[model samples]
Target: MNRRTFIESMGILGAASLLPISCLHMQPTTNYKLGYQLFSIRDEMTKDPIGTLKLLKKLGYQDFEIYGFDAEKGMYYGYTAADFKMILDDLGLTVSSGHYGFSGFLNAPEDILIRFVDQCIQGADTLNSAYITWPWIAPEQRTLDNFKIMSKKLNIIGEQVKAAGLGFAYHNHGYEFDDHNGQNGYDIILSETDAALVKLQMDMYWVMHSSKYTPKELIQKQPGRYVMWHIKDMDTKTRDYTELGNGSIDYTTLLPDPIASGLEYYYIEQGGNFAQNSIQSATDSATYFKEHLQKYL
Candidate 1:
């Protein structure tokens, strides 16, 4: 989905309960949540969330990062939070996090932001999601000034999320790396936000595609602040998102220390440019991830 449709909607479990495998002295991979961003197969999800989830489970996915939240209705896809949780529970699946429509309220009043955040909390509480993520900022709101302003809002939302025993995170896109003199929007977000309150969700594709910093370099900027990741590959020729391993990113060697990243959960995502179709792309990526990357993660 594009930014508008993504925003048109929009934490949970605490950090302590989600100790990273790397931090656990190379504990079994089963102890960690291997997830996929539903946006990668959004069409199938919209058509049949249950069946699509079942397919993902069969493909070895155990956790999910949800999207297309209807905040006004407190619904995901078309089911209420309670109903959706029941479905996941029945399937032996879990939601590690959610991508909510937070950018829409970037400039709204405190009351408005609070009201919306409370609504988000309700759904996340029901689903037991680990983090509620602010995925994107509209193009017009990407200015350096807005980046500073957005960081303040992140702290505000992060406070509420923490208060409710949930975590709050921000997911980055390529645009965040856009340079203004020597600094960029990401520099402001990393510096201005309260690390205790707010966390970072690194989209590796974006870091590889644009940022002057590599994934490891970015993680070094804030050791334990990065709690989640969106792993995808870029088309070698066009540099667009593609099925994992079908493109140029060699995650086998590219991954940083999960312990240092303070990582808990990660989602495999493909925004578009699927090799054949969305579900096929998801299946293919899952296969590659399980065979080549899940061990590293």
Candidate 2:
């Protein structure tokens, strides 16, 4: 089904009956790390990163995942990698992963792509990020041949990032699941990329929104391939952003096998529509996480 149709057809499930039967046996893990994606509150971050980070830290977040890395400026949210690292250090937070745009890899000259990757590796190293993630592929760039080319480019980039002593991962949206000749872009990505050199940052919301697979099934199908998770929820009615525990996704079923999924870090992220204020949403989500989800982590 197309994305729009899927979203409209999937009505919101009430909180009292949201958990799926599959999640009944799932249990939490003590070894997991909980983090917040900066994108969850991008407005606050863009205005005052230090203040924003301090607020998040105070709200009980211990780790961070950054997005919108500017290669030209060698910065994230207008702070150089070194500066950003220092700020995070002072707040007692560490960056686990950062999303890096891949348009350069797709459209830039060969030399430019190499330089971009090199710069990204250096920046990630400075921030002590465990993973440098390729976060999005523009819709116009999603053809079958483009997927093949992107897969090859990702392998090369992954090898370079691996050599730099960091992991490389790709984040997905529902579009990657688009069917092409009995296969899909996601299938190509999985088969063409070197699993040893590249890992996946699974966005559970998008996976579910695709209406093609469940997070648990994907974890089982490609064990050890996913290293990080973007922990967001889908509004039962709109299929849009919502805080964890309030949405239709059942973390109870998915968090049972972190070992099987190779999940080390999971970050809370709400794309745009916060239930209340951003800070309040984050605070509420964190509270729900500690009270409901922390035990399973």
Candidate 3:
């Protein structure tokens, strides 16, 4: 996916749990796995994937959701799937999912789309990733008509991914919540895609920023279908991305029941608007989450 458009498109789009603020804020705890999307530290990973993973692991992040798989080369960060997996293994880190570039095929022919999806599936298998996620569509393709077509393709892709013993999910941004007359793109996605085949990867920041429904209410609409989550906080004044606990979202009350949401994994992500720098933002978010938000998940 194009990281610049990932932020700039009309720009859009936002999960969770309940734990009292007083009860939280404890010393760093263990046993639970916290995930961070590598896209948050894309620059660092590009320069030094090994060093970046090592630092993120030291910050108490155990699970990861990766982005920008080079489908043509069948590589990630210039490393083959097996090699990358080995890197994570040596670092005591796990990558359960990834944001692949499937959105580019939104208008491509079936055969082309299938070819790309199959490539993504192979990469996922090599890494033992449980899910291959479709991150975002280009802004021009966000029309209601395209969403309908997108939903159909989602089912087809989901069927193929599921056949390979993996899960398929669509990650939402603010654009999906844009009102198209009475029906929004998200509505079409939820209503048209088969729940058994296509799962939802709810980005809590976009849901809150763009959608009218609260994260809890959105899950209530289709509870078990949501298999993944992108957890990020929104800047209070500019509505941009900020480090966790330094933004407007109130996870203490906003996080939905894990059981209700079919919550499998959640990743802390900030595409842009970092407080200091990307790596520091990742470390800061990790610290904030361990102290304040880990218990809720």
Top-lDDT candidate index: 1
When sorted by TM-score, best at the front, the candidate numbers are: 1, 3, 2
Task: Give a tens-digit lDDT track for model 2, residues 119-202.
Answer: 889889999989999998887898888888989888988998999899999999898998887878898899999999889989
lDDT tens digits, residues 1-297, model 1? 787765553312344337543444433443567789999999999899999999999888899999889999999989999999999999999998999999899999999999999999999999999899999989889899999999999999999999999999999998989999987999899889999999999999999999888888888879998899999999999999999887999887678778778899889999889989998998899889888777776
Give candidate 3 regions above 4 Å deviation: 1-32
lDDT of each: 0.89, 0.84, 0.87
Residue 170 shift from truth in candidate 3, angstroms: 0.8
Cα RMSD to the true fold for all candidates = 11.8, 10.5, 11.6
Candidate 3, 180-282: lDDT as tens digits = 7788999999999999999999999999999999888988899887888888999999999999999999877787766678878889999989989998899
Evaluated at residue 130, the lDDT of candidate 2 is 93
Off by over 4 Å in 1: 1-30
Ranking by lDDT: 1, 3, 2
TM-score: which candidate is best? 1
Model 1 lDDT, residue 49, Cα: 90
Candidate 2 TM-score versus the reference: 0.88
